[model samples]
Target: MTTPILLFLDINGVIDVEDTDVQGENLPQEYSTVYPVPGTKEFLQVIDSCSWIHPVWISTWGKQSQAWNKWAKTRCWPWAYPLDSDERHQALDLIGHGSDKYLAARWYSRDWQHRIVWIEDGFWLSSLYDSSMGAAVKWAENNSNVKLIDTAPTVK
Candidate 1:
């Protein structure tokens, strides 16, 4: 069997952002006003076509991921896959105070042997503020198995 790729997706910039650098701790509340990035449907379609890839939400939405899932469904996005509830809860438990996206992605995926693709827009921004985020950027720079799709926040 082919090794399934883990696609860790961030909603703020990679998907929900259009031309604004929307950042806040309001979480699922902030997500309510987000504008879907153009071509997001096509992106979802691509992931859907690739049966060997498993996509999981790694956004700041956090505990409200189910809300995001429901929103995606409303958009008719091919994003029906939900991360295992037990796994997600366990990973969140282990994740410390800071926004260590990479660390969370690692724990969420459960196996580094499989390729990981982190679709995010705040690597540079996050690096400037969060030390863990900075470390994650540095680590992704050297890890061949972990690929970072650093989408620009200004993506229109």
Candidate 2:
């Protein structure tokens, strides 16, 4: 049987929107905190119950991956994988004046390309909209993944 397809998650706008300074610019620090977005925990619970959903973090903040892992531990969010150094570099390299969606997309697993589903706040959607990987990216153009949720009370 084939392994489950990976679901790539973005932290800041997708999970939580905390203040962060990236290259002297203020941006969402999506990975440094443990608190989930409004319905994030519940959404994750559903993903956890599903055997086919392999959730993974795909954020620009490499420095916060460990912190995020620790946070995930409390919720048992199954954040086990870390992006490779090359992938990390690719993400960091995109930190510029504009959105980094395309740059982030480039860091996706080429081997498991279609498996990725980005959950970000549309920061870089337009730049990546026409890319071959656009459909894989989800969420509102101006909202965080967490904000897009309508709580289900519990994962069913």
Candidate 3:
């Protein structure tokens, strides 16, 4: 059986700008609205070339799946489907905490322990606390099978 590959994506900072930055003479305006960050589309294309890649959006706005769909369509970020029922419940459980990224990781594909990759900007490498969940995050952080792209835009 082929291992299922899960790609966890973040919205705000990873795919879009979190805030503005002051440059020498030109102030960089923040891209507050949702859109794929630089090189994101190319990255998605590369993953898509792989037959096992399964993309999943892991963001605080996951509750607003519709909004995310619209944004994805606009930016053309590859996606398979909105969060599944189990993932939705998991996200609901993490409501206000900035730990939604960690919560989403817990809701990865059923066989994700074998093959999974989380790509996001908000996830803290050392902040995961839940034993089972923490192990999973650490596995991704340490293993070559997984990757985390901190897409926080650079001020120019």
lDDT of each: 0.63, 0.46, 0.51
Better lDDT candidate (1, 3): 1
Q: Candidate 2 has which clashing residue pairs, if any?
A: 12-30, 13-144, 14-145
Q: In TM-score terms, which candidate is top?
A: 1
Write the residue-wise lDDT of candidate 1 on 1-156 in tens digits. 987888877777677764565442222445545566666657766775777887777766665654555544422222212335675566667654335566566675555477888888867777777776776677678877778888865334
Error of 3 at 141 (Å): 5.5
Candidate 1 Cα RMSD (Å): 6.6
**lDDT (tens digit, per residue) of candidate 3 on 1-156:** 678777776655665553344111211232234444455546655655666766666665544533444433333334323456776576557432333345446545444565566665534433344453354446456777676554433334
When sorted by TM-score, best at the front, the candidate numbers are 1, 3, 2
List runs of model 3 lying over 4 Å from the truth.
Answer: 1-4, 18-32, 39-50, 63-98, 125-147, 152-156
- For candidate 2, the 10 contiguous residues with the lowest summed lDDT are 145-154
Give the residue spans of candidate 1 off by over 4 A.
Answer: 1-3, 18-31, 63-98, 153-156
- What local lDDT does model 1 show for residue 103? 55
Best by lDDT: 1
Worst lDDT run of 10 residues, candidate 3, spans: 22-31
What's the ranking of the predictions by lDDT, best on top? 1, 3, 2
TM-score of each: 0.65, 0.47, 0.50
